[model samples]
Target: MPGLTFEKLLLIAIIAVFVLGPEKLPHYAAQLARLVKSLKNMASGAKDRLRDEMGPEFNDVDWQKLDPRQYDPRRIIREALLDDEGAAAPVAVKPPTRSRPVESAAQKRLGLAEAGAAAPFDSEAT
Candidate 1:
């Protein structure tokens, strides 16, 4: 079904005719059809057996949710980390407070001002 298009199937048929010859082609084709039919019947029979063993619960089962391919690692981790209620509570934060300004090393070396005092301006430096 995936890769067997009409063109590819036609090519295969042509090749088979050349290899197997016209005389034996019909016999082989009938055998192949029978094999495919038997395989389908086996698969359906297995499904029916499983359904009988499972009883009415088989129809109630969520097939899509149970599928392994639908699972996501990130979502599983997130769910595991969450509370039983599912929603996360909001956190409270404190407002920032103003602090004293820092003094520069030049101001300390010049000895022009105290450690926390503002520096005096020099007109030439500008």
Candidate 2:
């Protein structure tokens, strides 16, 4: 998730100058500029299409809430496990115990917890 800072961009530009040489640098730079402009146009076109199709409601829409970056598996599972009445009672998750390993629905389906099931082997893997 690290972003390209000014220093990082400068370093890359310096490296590209040596690698590409001065002769082809302008040509590649123009191509890169064109690519960026085309990407912008495409994005704008999509947004315009969506706005036209959705009408006034499009402007009122909460874009941040629709972002995929906010998705978290643990948060989703925790929310799903919450009680209907919103009580403080703990969620009952039956994980494999130390004394006796229990086969969960997922484990059973994956054949990982099946009795007498041998580990998968490939002769050529080694």
- Candidate 1, residues 48-92, lDDT tens digits: the string is 999999999999998988999889999898877784576668578
TM-score on alpha carbons, each prediction: 0.52, 0.69
lDDT of 2 at 22: 100
lDDT of 2 by residue, 12-116 (tens): 999999999999999999999999999999999999999999999999999899999999999988777774566677679896558655667866777779665
Note each model's CA RMSD in angstroms. 17.7, 4.4
Clash list (residue pairs), candidate 2: none
What's model 2's lDDT at 60? 100
Model 1 misplacement above 4 A = 67-126
Off by over 4 Å in 2: 86-120
Q: Residue 71 in candidate 1 has what lDDT?
A: 91
> Residue 72 lDDT in model 1?
94
Q: After superposition, how far is residue 118 of candidate 2 from its true place, in Å?
A: 6.0
- Residue 29 accuracy (lDDT) in model 1: 99
TM-score of 2: 0.69
